[model samples]
Target: MDTQSAKDTVDIDLGGVSPCGEVIGDLGDDDMVTVLTGMKLNLAFFSEKVANLRNFVMHLETLGVELEGFVLDREDNDVDVGCVGKFLEFDLLCGVLGSEVVELDRFLDTLYAEIADAGERVTSCKPWQDNLLDPEQCLKQSEEQFSEIKKLSASFERTLSSYKRGGIGM
Candidate 1:
């Protein structure tokens, strides 16, 4: 328990949960480094989920446009149950990400109004991905969700970037 020991520096408790959500453990400096690296890896996982969301939206658009064409020209893609399922899945994902989007938007709105707000260092993460594989295209489909999500994503990223660049200070 001496501060000279590398393990003493981090105050880790493998036996109990810390207020920060990390487990209390006898962590050495090396272990702390590993934890940080793991956190960075988790961030990559979040980015991939975001990309998956993007990919899904693209398919949704494709489906919607194709469905619209079908409606007009009698091409008939909606009669397929699978397409409906996929759209439903994207809707659920949208709900999940959109909640975070709302929170992020609000945080930015208030944060930006501050005269000396530090740019957001909030590290958001998606804990899981769930819902829908119902496809109508006879193959992987995501165009309908793609178009819808792309707009929200663009707005989110633009605002985030502005915050990063000291928009609050301006």
Candidate 2:
């Protein structure tokens, strides 16, 4: 196709609010490809990250429970053998770890719901002549959804770092 005709036909108006909530204009084939590809990549990354987080949470919970049991199994007289300090340490650690694990589980639930919603939107879109689907509403919804995931991912990373630094209460 000629450049002019291609340009004219390629323009797709997804008409919606911008990332900053302002009005948006037309999106060309290139723009659509960028958005679509970005959404796809975001979904993949988000899924993997969530999976890793869930595995980590599970491991931490199991270790926390086991540590609690071990501490409880120690007799009172064992404190003189340095078990007292160990028990106290495990008690505080488990409490903090348990709360963090709960928070992570809640985050996973919310993230999974958002991912499902985005997947539904993507599946609902019908393709154009060139086999590209660029529903404006879906793109906008996806952009918003992706933004949320990015924010959540950053927050999770910060929390993980805090934990590494022994800031379990974080």
Highest-TM-score candidate:
2
Residue 44 CA error for candidate 1 (Å)?
1.0
lDDT of 2 at 85: 45
Q: Note the residue pairs that clash in candidate 2.
A: none
lDDT of 1 by residue, 64-136 (tens): 4553343344332324454345434444444565665455445434433321111111112111100011111
Candidate topping lDDT: 2
Ten residues in sequence with the least summed lDDT for candidate 2: 127-136
Candidate 1 has a TM-score of: 0.33
**Residue-by-residue lDDT tens digits, candidate 2, 1-170:** 75447658986343543233333344444454565566555545545545555565455455545544544665543433343344345445445545554564465455456545444433433442122333334434544554454454454445445433542322
What's the lDDT for all of these models? Answer: 0.40, 0.46
